[model samples]
Target: MENSSPLVLMLLGAALMLCLHPLQAQIDGTGLFHDYYAKSCPKAEEIIKSIVEKAVKKEARMAASLLRMHFHDCFVKGCDASILLDDTSNFTGEKTANPNRNSVRGFDVVDNIKAALEKACPGVVSCADIVTVAARDSVVLSGGPSWIVPLGRRDSRGASLQGANQNIPAPNSTHQTLETKFKLKGLDVVDLVVLSGGHTIGLSRCTSFKQRLYNLTGNGKPDPTVDQGYLKQLTTLCPQTGTDDNQTTPLDLVSPTKFDTHYFKNLESGKGLLITDEILYSTKGSKTAALVKFYASHSQAFFQQFAKSMIKMGNITPLIKPSGEIRKNCRKMN
Candidate 1:
């Protein structure tokens, strides 16, 4: 295989090119531009994930909430500036208490970055901006996204749990359904496939896969081609029974530990473990083969586009100042 590092760097460089696009990124009122997401600082996103993983492990419901936020933000408007709080409740509802989990307090990671920035630039940035920045940063850490994004956009007061519930896509949605839903948010097939890479870092509860593992009546269950040994292990661990949501599975196939092109590789190998993942390749007209080849022949190619898509996602039309209010808490408002 071609050396991976140079290719990835080239992809990253291209992603950073977006900052220099005609949009004119504003950094401290100066016309000068910087490739914000070009390199480094994606650790903030990883920190949030680390926290979220803990949250999920500690409490699924709460972890689900954070997961919902990440997905909602990423899918709706291309991970735009609006996902984090910036406005007051547009609708009202009962507030549910969040169970104890570290990631639920995503602020932990955001705050760290804020503190670092404050020392470096002192109030030149906003938490709202930090959260978005951290997201792109996290993508890079996960071996994706390299585009620079705008900063200084203030936070909002709106972060509704119910809205999140309504916006996030389900695990079992078909390609037609998923494509339609993603389109409503201005996303495309490529964005959907790439962002789904988030699965690389998270876990899937047995509840999400039980139907695929056991209840299928026809070809609904595991494919006949799956390794018999692997098939037996799944049965032994998840055994079609009561409340098996406790079992977890990794989303990445090769080098699951490192967030790389392995996920695409997995799809090529028919090792996509999730029903949603399996669809990526099995679905007709998908770029699965192309993405896999591109990443292998040019691993950086994936990250570059992934990064550009991420910045595009983050730029989603946010309800901004004078148009929205800052939510005291992220869970609910209305």
Candidate 2:
């Protein structure tokens, strides 16, 4: 009986480990695992989380910016930190891409995280993994669901200026265009609706959606789908002319700094801040409209699906060891 009890305990321990680190089994196939740095850099995720928390504390909007960085990076070149590269004399980077130019902020925070990680672990952690982990931490700090990020991604040697401009869905993207863009990345409609929830904690510049408030569809009238009061509010914040295009407003007026279902709720009431945002609920016979309604009514469901979708997005064509190098500096190839 004593021997049997010991064997039983051993089996239970194995089961517990499997449950705790399910992605560990994929380290061989996908070259990613929940504990990819368990031996190489035990404090990789901890270091990232701490830096992200400090950045978000200083500026709540930074949480969304960091999260957006991950999305933009992954969409451009499979989340290998290609978006982090800066243009040099001989090369152009994605920073100047139409979708990214002056829009994607938080590079300084990423550089800070990278500097700290490089100091602690040297070349053990890659900037790609740091960006991915920082993104998850940003969401958690903003009151969103937490998920285990599969790590071990390496950095790309080059940035894709063309891919950055073409791949990312714009604020004026149609529902079909958005879905097609996501599909190209192996994401489906569910991923689209849930991932769009990321706007819940961020702000959008006036230029991104100003047309919705004035001259949508080239007409001198605002988008009829926007609620009358919301249209008035947006117009005041984003005037037709002589307004700074860089002026920003909360993407989710209900709870802009906190990650929640308010984005979905706002969509239901026609207060969605972006044309792309409103399209999810306002487009005629949109498959996304049902999803927006479902998520609006089920906050927990939105949170859970969001975590799953993020994990899926993080897995897009990662460059594992031997395929790419670990970049010491995120801004330029090392």
Candidate 3:
């Protein structure tokens, strides 16, 4: 046979990868069902909801933290709970990654839910599924739309610190960067916009968006996309020297405690906290800009899309059947 063309080789390589990682096709919920745990652990989601409800009642921000944990966990390694791993002698965990360290919280909440599930139905529920359920419950508790989460995800045996750092979109990521990051995860522009709405309730540390307040583009100027009034407030809260990294501000200043369309409204008014958030609106002629506007005007549309997108996100490359283990401790390999 004649030598294969470069295009043919590329197509063959893509096909081979799909065969090797068949779970990648599951992002659309191919092998997953909404009640995958109904028989194995009937009370699995209920247990998670109870714990998350109490936690959020005690501290409302916990809802956002839990939601963020799910996002971080999924983006790094296909929602496999690699972000939940703790550093060990043999491996460094994703927890220490630049995007996650001091940012992603709610591991204890996951632990609490896992312990409850273990008591109720030992070894039946996976920590990965626990995080997924907690995320759904967190949204519902925080006044966001809820969806039936498909289960049967298993925990990975390894962590990917590098993947966490490189894959998770940073607070300073550009519009193109955010789009590419979501696309790499089998998500689309709509997914990116709707998922970003999760920011409507979360708290972002000063470190996450200090550049927008201080030295954007190393020019020693605030991001012009930021509202001048909001910039003044941010400068007062976050200093020009940028020392208070641990200090947090709500990602959505309009209605920080509620998971609503205010985040898109903030973007429209140049009040978005992070460059990544603001760019969704400021990126001229971008599809994301249009989506932001649409969501801002029609919250019902945003809520519906958010629920659908979240389900799609939860389905990212789950390890089914005998592929991964049901971890006893979410932070350690089984």
Could you give me the TM-score of model 2 versus the true structure?
0.94
lDDT of 1 by residue, 196-263 (tens): 65555555556565565664436656654344665666667677766445776655535543556777
Candidate 2, clashing residue pairs? none
Identify the candidate with maximal TM-score. 2
By lDDT, the candidates rank as: 2, 3, 1
| Residue-level lDDT for 279 in candidate 1 | 75
- lDDT-wise, the better of 2 and 3 is 2
- What count of clashes does model 2 give? 0
* RMSD, one per candidate, in order: 9.7, 2.6, 9.4
After superposition, the stretches of candidate 2 with alpha carbons farther than 4 Å from their true spots are 1-24, 27-29
Using alpha carbons, what is the TM-score of model 3? Answer: 0.90
